[model samples]
Target: CGIFRLVVPCGAGKTISALRYALQTAERYEKRRIFYIAPYNSILEQNADEIARYIGDDSAVLRHHSNIVFKQDDGEKETKYKLLTENWLQSPVIATSAVQFLDTLFASKTSAVRRMQALGNAIIIVDEIQALPIKVLKLFNAAMNFLSSFCNTSILLCSATQPLLDELNDYRICPPRDIIQDVDRYNEAFRRVEIVDCIRGNGFSSDEAADFIFGLAQKVKSMLAIVNTKATARRIAERILKLSCGDSEYKVFHLSTNMCPAHRSTVIREMRRYLSDEKSSKKIICVSTTLIEAGVDLSFEHVVRSLTGLDSIVQSAGRCNRNRETICGTLSLIYINDEKIGKLDHIKEAQEITREILYHIHMNADRYPGGALSKAAMDEFYSKYYRSLKREMAFPLKDDPEHTIIDLLTNSPVGSERKQTAGGILLKQAFREAGEAFEVIDNTGKHSVIVEYNDDARKHIHILLSSHFIYEQKKQLRYLQQYTVQLPTYTIEKIGAGIVQENEIGVMILSNEFYDKVYGIDDELKI
Candidate 1:
């Protein structure tokens, strides 16, 4: 009775609908709280704040994620307690990123399970479910089954382009019934955007993409170009600014993780202001990373998206004509073949398969069901993608007989008393092994720095170095959440003699010369 699916398209009011459903589900089913798990902290914070507004009680909502530390407040110690003790099992309505959600289920640490008791009989809504890494699909699926069947919790899988999870042989997840109502009718009713594939014969180099995007920028009142890498976004945005020389009518901006959350939020607000009123004359062109593709609700007249995955392309399309602001918005899908795309192996593989589907659709339009954004096309794309990466999906451990942690967890060798067998074999989830294996963001050697971008940031930094110790530092950490950036491990290593102060646990302070007001962390230094 707990496992359900929300199969709505992107930009179709999924968040608000989830909020309303959460309220009703809580009231009717006697569920104590609703837990929302988003793919990114930015998305989780954005939605949690919005839901707080709708519920008319900000304090009722508690945010839990890796990026957040407790701020000044004695009454709201539950959140702080979780922070201090690492037990995150309370709150009436909890908002967390997928990383935190998985840690609760898979991590072997004592702190990870302290809150597991609270998960029973709760309402769990997972947004962007399709974004789950292919390698951990089997593990995540099994965890969901445990939560729903054994824990007495209700689960809802939500996404615009929901994957065919039930179709996967290794990890089959079948919902009781899809909440999509009418799949075809719902899809037909919300057709506010058309996807156009312009990947071309050899894909675009950075120069070619920037030139093409600049040309596209001139025609629309508001446009968004989403790239895969921050380096590409910076390079392309800088090139556009250079080419603009004297064009003052158009407002151009660059957005990525390089910018703090607050800075990105400010940029989003400005973009929405320009898009809301047609009478405004100036155009807005934003060059951004894939961060804007999820939960962010601003729309544009056109979206220029670089191909990565079918799920990503759909999310990008959601940002254009999101509320039916226009008759129809256009999605210009292009493929880049250069180093500009970064070294994400999964994305590169998905890129190839997406192109194969698009090429086939281009060759024969009649046979394909719903054009590029149709169900038939996405189904074929993911099916091939999963098949291509089947071996990786099991998440095999190299030294541990190439068997997945999921295999070990389900088939345990350790008996009831937490003791090993006579043959000296130890196997049971390999909690430590699984924890070490998880790399959602892979910030291994990266260091987190509090960027002094404004007065608010500076005030926090002062408290950070003060005698208040970890408590004061943690309070500042909360304040600096939106004003934080992760520099590469190598960049921190090259802080040089007396250049800057650093720590072994991934904390570094930026000197005046290394920080920039515009780009947050200075990208001028070559890593």
Candidate 2:
């Protein structure tokens, strides 16, 4: 029945330290279960592998993500994994995505709430806690408070750039006990990258940005550029490819959500091989979206990140010289003049706030003794960023603007007229309505399309279509998750039914003509 926070810098062994603490604390308190949750599947997979290696048995840890596929060759092992995922009851340690774990508390679906009982007296570790949506912060805080204070569960929040959750003016978490003493001192000591701000005058165009990145990659021999959109990443990658046409040593790679998970994984493995080969003079340049920023174990000599929130900048920097291969890697922050963040209001606001912070740092350089990546700098950035987003933190309902998700969950007058109480007050909660309004990721018009990227993907799709049993079909769908890419409904509609076949399970199977082996999903179809 404790709420705690672990605020250590990235690349400083935070994952292992948190795992060791959770295991010991769970053993001491006799906790029923241990849950390791992260914002991205990549993080969960990496940490789960590490945990399995540490414990000496892989089966001891249960993976509960949409993309996980147990060895289908071993029917017993596959059945064991499926049963464990059904209720999360058998596994002592469960590694899952943040969305799946959060749904247990917030979602109203029967399948989701059935696992809520598993959380009782559990040790829950949420990594990259700041990545949680801004609108859901109040609901998240309230839920965490209830879990720790009433349900006898222990909640551990871990992040390099922790948001000021307890200091919020509205619904907020109780003061969390810090696991590490002198977090700022530890962060300073573990600093591995130097921040270089490149958003001076008019920012670089698409071509200019590619040239800048190519020049740096030539010198460093390994570089990564993380941008805001897939189109921009592709544009930069294509430009870099043309720039290095004559040099067979330079390999330019493009990675984005447009590519399926399996494709991205293959690309990542190839990049790692090139990076680990010390004898080779190969130059590696990867241009990717923000998906690469979350806990991915790929290290580059230098990283170029588009200007966004301070937390994201730091996360991108984590991939640069992660093991401290050099004295200090450089993270160049650039602004792409041609980029358009249409309808991405949150990103736009964060960009503006970051620009202000950069201005402050430029004006008052003497005030920041530890440079831009310092703890003090992060504090200033989040304080202002959170202040700007104070209104949206409550997760307000669109239809009923007066009431919020917290109001609906706690005390909404849903059945007031139908069932009047003695005091004429309706104490009944609108659980269904609240769940309908709550979304971990905004998927308003988003549609998942399963692509036949390789033999493995096509095999899963065949199983998905041919299977008669509901359970087998469900398992096949989960297997297909790695072969799927999400596109907007309008984009799919524009591509027409000729290119996509909508299945009975409400997913589209992309035609081979629209799917590319290298770029993925064909950029020509992009709206």
Candidate 3:
């Protein structure tokens, strides 16, 4: 009837359990529809597949995300799919990214607002709820309040380490009911991996870290290292490959946003094959960015995670010993001294705070009886993290330092009562300004570049270039999303027109020379 939260450990099957609850509630209350939202495209893809299998009808679930592209079909099928995607109402169950869901609730664009009515009398399930950006705390809480209070919608938020949303001073949501009576019991029961802190005075250099990770992989036979940035990930992966030059049995893989969706999926599939096959003799080592930290289904014998937020560490640890098959799996947290995080203010701040928390945990272990991954530790982490980010939680506008997105959407100084004339209220709420200012991800200077990674990608690009009609090319562009990567415009420019250039249809396409078969876009390609 209102907003309810479910707190469960990573491996407790929260996905299917949440689905069961949503279905039951929908059937009982005769809800209009059910929407399952996640924070990233990776999580959306996994959940969409699982929900399709559970419902026993793939067509009943509508996937709405950046990577989703419906195949070319007959006119009837195309029209039906297009209509469902446009308004997001006809589908019985919709699996979409949080970007889409949040925009539908907050964005002022007609295309986005058109779907807002569909959310009424619906049950919304949000997975990995803590992945929300700190800047949108107040706005997100306000949106949830509107949907639950006035729209007759039920919202279920599921997270391993939930944030304290109620602690916000303004636009707070109703106090949510906890579905799980004792979350600490489940946390203890699902405890599979232990955290090994490897952070020292100035941390280890990339070469030293790579050497240590390589040695550990040789012993463990399977390991995953998640770094903070793409440059660090590629550097560590290349160094590991150089160290294991003559080792024929070892397979090294790299994953980051620089790789297209299809390429990343292919790498993940191969990693899973080697990890799951008991008879296979291949020793697998994967170096990836934080993209693989949440809602990814890969399990490793050992994991190395770059020091960041405690919540992120918990999510990374979920990838190790996930099935509880290993007797003792370890997730070593290390700090790369040479890694440059100057532009990554959030991660840097979180790292400093996490270091402090780890120091306290080591010095006073008795206070945190449930260890680092316990509820007690998570509570302290969020409390400190939120306090540090209190100023940004209001989503202050950069260009207009005097007001915030909340103020623009609700009350603006321009639309005061004194300005009204003849009993007519002036349009004071700045919808266009707010919409232009809001960004789920900072896309200020980013541009999407379609890469010719495989035969399918090339086929799409060829069609996109050769198509005579603009409508056909639009469809081809959608199909190419599975093979596209977003890079900073400055980086693209520095890479030079020799490697990246616009096609006949004005789409940015990266040549094959700069992309690697295993490591994705070459970090050294930039001039």
Candidate 4:
């Protein structure tokens, strides 16, 4: 394998360089298609926009993710539609999420099966490769191997803190060099950051954190605090607003996935405008989720990060002092023990390994002899991390009886005997399975009904009722109007009681007593 790594720090033009490599490879091999996979939809959209700008054609690039608005020219009018119904491989340049890409490898859906044929004889760039799901690492590695060896594809594993993918016992894919030859060069180029390791027990509390942020806003030009969860971010923002003086004129912003992409983009644009305008002294403070960890190239003078995995900590550090100016900026890593660090077992184990290494290095200064964390320290960190979790690194679902059950439900071959025999039962079983509950808001401002499922059926009913049907349905007889549902204002008061279930149609909500009390709806209603 002639695969190689391109290790560049934040704001080092890695995305553009990767795209350049892909384009060169395509021209050299005369490849027709190129696949660029990212960890998030915003990133996918961002990269697609940049690629399209460089490539000089929007038609050459295709953005396939949730929230993508596609316009179809059917001659009746330019209709805004969705890309989910479109063929994924039809475009020469495809931008998608890692989940969508990997799901295609394991499942046999129309999108999954159809994209497989286009994967061959193409150049695939896996951006932020370290963010690859731990449970799917083995499956991903196997898939990469099969694609590189059998399928005519070239992969560029791009990231700052690159994981030890080849060291795993079941590893299959291998790259030529550690893509990043000189880590110090990147450090020198981006010399804007001065990492401040805040001592534990002295760190800011919820209220203190708010005060500190407000003080910083008054002093510094711009700032950002990247926390762990949405709820924490919201709490911090609320505290800041409460403590602020009258007419203080501070522009505070809260950003998280809880808001839609359109909303998030609007916030990001406002932040950028504030940063770029020198005349406007409107102090800006943004409290965000881990979504800003990678690919988002927003530069700030100071950043406060709650203690997380080492890779995440490093990425957060990258955002601060990003410009590498003469004045080295400070980044405070506050030790947050309250955060519930679940999911991604590999990252949790990596954090422990990093802590132990840091402790040992700090205790025996003469042995390591480095005042600051060195590149060798990071290398050793990842090496130890891979060695410790190699056995459990592969897909956790493999050989699990439940996966077989899920496969039967989701990927039973079309018209197969088992699928036909158990499909309906499996579909019903899926509905019975509980899912994450959501407050399904409709347009009429009325608490009409609640359903156990939030799938296509529920969506259709919500849309229809919100549309012109509400007035017509109201005119109908009271008994016939029972089926017409609407979302109410009080429904917003309910926080966490509905269990979202999945059916063949889509995601459904399992209504509970709490929902009944919140919406004041009859429990005997069919919903």
Candidate 5:
């Protein structure tokens, strides 16, 4: 099996080139499956559709993410029912997430580990591989090493800015060829963007950001402002609406993960149509979260980005000057100080590292003007960043010691020469005790139901319901629509209780009581 690493910038045809490589691999090796793993479901959905269209074969494609599988089905619910009635691995081209693939390597259940067989003799293209959990870096690399060495599989590390996966101690798997040999050559060929570091005092405030956007909207045909969070995006969009007098003249759009995939797709399609139309002024202004950082191909003459991770900043830059048609447009990286920004664990660390790098670049711009923000600079940033976070990165899943426990449980018998047997048993017992805290819901409902609640629970329940691509919830059912609900555990102790019931429709429960009581419903009802 062959390996490669592609470090092309965004909108540089990475996806298509990777797809072509995968096809070539399949044809050359006579492989049956091609696994395309992405960081997000939105990207998986987009790529799967495009592949299906190009291949001209619906049967060859399989989309296997939690969000996309259970999304609100279009009018073709019946057709979808017939299509997804079987296991996902049977398809020739499968799209999934890195978590799903890695889960199989450390799976405790038979169902979760079943996909391991399909991974053999396949072309695995990991898009945006840097988005992988830092803690699982060791485990992820080990799995890739095993697959590439023993299972007759080829791995493609694909990203705009590839992370330092190979730098890890005892890292396994190496690319056969450098996909983008000279990044500077590719950058020069595909460079259409100009970076503008806004002077600190001149940067836009919340109110001023809106005013500046409104001014741009009046001048340009379309503009996009990529902010750091959903709250800020919505607030900025609202401010722009208030400041602009002729609200009816121009269209203002707000995009974030707060909206479901179906909703976002509708918005994206509408925007594309408006931009493509010749007569329509459109004057579109879209404020979005980091969700639009990749896989979305939208071009704008002006892009204003809130300070964030360097990779994300580059991704935002990619959205601007996309076609290289714009001679000299500006991408403003504004300095925004919000305490809430630090709440994001990963982004917080990234921001700190980026700030330090910017400090150095500010002192010596002639040597590292924009180069400080390039992929090579990011490499240095993460190297130091990981060293500082080595302990955390080494054991991210400290809560789950089952893999170690299982190895000990199977390898060493009781009353044997293995001195660690007692320690392993203790760890296993602790894990088993902690596992009881999580309740597994049975989602075998007869009529599809929607769990509605406040935004937080709603998001979780939505992910669970859509986990296996089951999207037939009733929109007219209000009671079922608003409260967060989970599948009731099938254990005998949890059956036929007030908060937990076993009906034909599946295990139904009230999430509030379940969380508050801590005990199973049967015990709570007895109390």
Candidate 6:
């Protein structure tokens, strides 16, 4: 029935605090269900396990997500967990990925709809609210507004960099009262990194940048380099390996959506040991896409980020000086003159607005010695950003303002288009059309593919494809969670021969020949 926001910055204990609220709400409200939604599974896995332990009962906890379970069960009997996922019932505390939550909000299927009504009166916690894509902001806002107004849900928007959703004219709610009372003090308490502009010389290409990082690797214990694309990440990692003199003792890690969840998990576990060992002199360099910017939590002495949104810059900064173990970590914004990132309009636009903010701050650099990420600088940065992007906060489609998925889902009037009845009830909800228009991950369409990541995943895949025993198949699915990755839909069509194979279940499979041992899904996959 209300909205509350926790504007806690990253690495500032938001997860633990959110869990406390979930527990308190369950106890205070008497078995009211609690829905905790995060933007990525990397966070869900870590937080879900922690929450299950703190709550003192595994039976009460629910982890519902796309990776864990598929929508179609194919005549197999449902497990208790799968049944809960289907009905969204009887669990006091549930954690899910943002994709699952958003997709469910607009899904037309009977199973997906069954969960929506039960969400009324639950405590809905949306973490990393800023990460919501601009194209879908209007739809997301409408969904949030409906949940609070009609469903009577206490919606909590939690993020270190809260986007202030209700600020839009028609979004919803009175200015949400901050759940984290002292915003200024909270940010001050967790100040861990300093932003430094790495604009020097002729600007560095991915190759030159990797060489620069390779040199730094010889001196530093651990570092992270974040780039815009998977291709760029792979190029940098390749450059690093080639530039090595074959004499250095170090490890270069590559991470992206190309790697299955299980592969990424293995890399993270191995890297964590190296990062935590202070006595060990091994240097570690991780080349990754923006996936590492948000949830994966390993701190590094230095972080080099390809120019992107200021919000993403803040996230990248979070990965630095994360543990508060040092004086301050360094966050450098790298300008790759040779690389041109124009395909993604959203990211490119954000980068343009960020550059403008940087220009204004660069003019007064002497007054504010802390660079563009300082409190005052960040305020100005976001001001220009939100102002420039105010219209885009609402979703739009060409020649059809009345037909955007947002208008259809909410039954909102759209300028002489759809009419309502005297009862103020929509005659047609158009659930199927809404679902067709909604694409949480589709900047471009992607196809989910299973991979032979390891022996465990291979065994699970085989069992899942052939097994008739319902219990064993259900268990195999939980095991296969880490072995799935989504590839661009076009890529799957092009590489359809020896590499891509369709299983009996009708899902795509990328053979081992196509999966890279190092960078994952060979950089040459596009061809």
Q: Which stretches of candidate 3 lie over 4 Å from their true place?
A: 73-75, 414-424, 499-504
Off by over 4 Å in 5: 67-89, 170-176, 199-205, 362-373, 398-527
Ranking by TM-score: 3, 2, 1, 6, 5, 4
The 10-residue segment of model 5 with minimum total lDDT is: 515-524
lDDT of model 6, residue 217: 67
lDDT of candidate 1 over 400-495, digit per residue (tens): 545666655565332312434434454444456566665555565666766666776777666666634665555666667777778776666665
TM per prediction: 0.89, 0.94, 0.95, 0.73, 0.74, 0.87
Once fitted onto the true fold, the runs of candidate 1 whose alpha carbons sit more than 4 angstroms away are: 66-90, 277-279, 396-403, 410-429, 435-439, 494-499, 502-506, 522-527
- Which candidate would rank higher by lDDT, 3 or 5? 3
**lDDT score, candidate 4, position 104:** 64
Query: Best candidate, TM-score-wise?
Result: 3
Model 2 Cα lDDT, one tens digit per residue, 194-293:
8899875889998999999998887887899999988888888889989998588888789998999999989998988988988888888999999988
Between candidates 2 and 4, the one scoring higher on TM-score is: 2
Listed per candidate, the RMSD to the true structure in angstroms reads 3.4, 2.2, 2.0, 9.5, 9.2, 4.0
- Give the per-residue lDDT of model 3 (tens digit) for 1-527: 79999899877799999999999999999998999999988889988999999999999999888886767666677677778979988999999989998888777778898999899999999999999988788889988998999999999999888887876666777999989988889887878889999887788898889998998998877899999988899888989999999589898999998888999999888888888898888888999999998889988989999889999998999889886648868999999988888777878888888898888999999887667788778888888888887768778887776788888777865444433642555577766778877877767678888889988888888888878898998888988988888878677877777444545567888888777777777655742
Off by over 4 Å in 4: 71-89, 202-204, 323-326, 342-350, 360-374, 398-527
Report model 1's TM-score to 2 decimal places: 0.89
lDDT of each: 0.75, 0.84, 0.85, 0.62, 0.63, 0.74
Say which prediction, candidate 2 or candidate 6, comes out ahead on lDDT: 2
Clashes of each: 0, 0, 0, 11, 9, 4
For candidate 5, report its TM-score: 0.74
Give the range where candidate 1 is weakest over 10 consecutive residues by summed lDDT: 413-422
Residue-level lDDT of model 6, residues 175-274, one tens digit each, is 5767777665667677788888876766797888898777766666778999998888888988887776444577788998888887888898989988
Query: Which candidate number would show the highest lDDT if scored against the true structure?
Result: 3
Assess the local accuracy of residue 378 in candidate 4 as a C-alpha lDDT between 0 and 100.
61
Order the candidates by lDDT, highest first.
Answer: 3, 2, 1, 6, 5, 4
